[model samples]
Target: MGDTNSDSPTASPEAAFEAPPTATVSLREDQLQNAVSFLSHPKVRSSAVEQKRQFLQRKGLTDAEIEEAFRRVPEAPAAAYVPAPSPHSVVAVPAGTVTPAGYVPVQQQQLVPAQPQPVRWGQAMLGAAFVAAGVYALKVVVWPYVADAVTKWKASQGEMAEAKALQEKESNALAEAIQAQTSELRNTVELLQKLTVSLEASVAESKRAAQDSLSLADLRAELRTLAGTIREQRPAAAPPAPSVDVGRELASIKQLLANGVGT
Candidate 1:
């Protein structure tokens, strides 16, 4: 138990001499200032940036604003622009460079197209006269002639109507004349019929007279026979019957009657 205790590990002098010391190399104020000055140099420009400090001091830029500006810094973009003219007008400007021409006032030129030549009073009057003449001709000569022709045509038509009426009247008169002629012809035929009847009556009367004459002749012949018989039978009575040749006496009487009838 004593050996076990003597063999147990414990801190020794050589082990202590081998152990590390806790001594620190503390920085001095001059050394720290020298290091800060070296880093802050304009050429090196480290340690929170002397450039940012100088820029904030000289140009009134904050450190965060300067960092933002530096971060945004890229190569400048190329652009085409016309610069305003210098206040002193120098002769070194290139040919086509523009100045502040917009600021200057300019008077606009009054532009008017050329007016066509006006028609002369005489020519215009002549054109108007021609139109008026045409209108006058239409109203006076042409229209009147046309109207006269229409009137004449109407008159001719009226006359033709009159002539047609006259013709119709004449035709009616002709019809009346023809009807009268026909009536006259009918009357003439009636007269001819009456004449024929009269002629027939006259013929009947002539035949009756002939029959009467025959009967009278027969009675006379019988009387002559009786006279002859009486004369023969009786003695010559009363002066020999006047020596009567009856035949000769009858012939003389007939001759007298014939002469009277002729008269």
Candidate 2:
């Protein structure tokens, strides 16, 4: 019982005791105020109070939510006017103009615009030659050949189509004739069988008929006589000169065109 005063008020060496942490707190109020101030500035374009109310109404926000928003809002000063430059031209001060004291001079100069250089004499000559070449092509080189080619192509294509058609018709007729000759040969074989039977009957019944049958000498003579007749009367087809399709060639040539300045 010498000094039983444990509850006595004594200054502790440590710092003051802290309360139970209900929420975190910091010295960030100025930053929060600044952000709100920026949002509420007069020049800053933002939805009006009525608009925000309508938006919150459309969102089905409670009156309590709207009140919390109004409380968090901050006020700011109205915007001040700032000058802007014109795009058409710059305002220039004269060289001898005087300014206020402590006004720093910015020694600025505008860059000079560059201009195109003149071409050399040789280049000029080349340009003239190119123009002259274009003129010469139109006046002297192209029209005559084009005209000739057109005439030749039109006529040749017409003839070529006709000739091709004629050739096809002739070939068809020739094939028909060859088929007729084959049929005739078959019929001639049947007739020759009857003739052979008759000739054999005559020879078997009469020796005079066998005696009238041509000898090998007469057969040889008749064969020689027929050969002479074929040699004298046969006609020859003059070998056709190899033909070229000039119409197609002319058409191909005329269709080609040159491009660029001289074309």
lDDT of each: 0.58, 0.55
Q: Write one digit per residue (lDDT tens) for candidate 2, span 38-105.
A: 23434432546676556444544445544554567643346899776544445566789887688665
Q: TM-score winner among the candidates?
A: 1
Which 10 residues in a row give candidate 1 its minimum summed lDDT? 11-20
lDDT of 1 by residue, 11-123 (tens): 22111111122442343222222223333333334224554446333433334544444444322345779897654444554569776756453344556789999879999
Residue 146, model 1: Cα distance from true site in angstroms: 0.8
Model 2: weakest 10-residue lDDT segment is: 11-20
Which candidate tops lDDT? 1
Clashes of each: 0, 0
TM-score of each: 0.35, 0.27
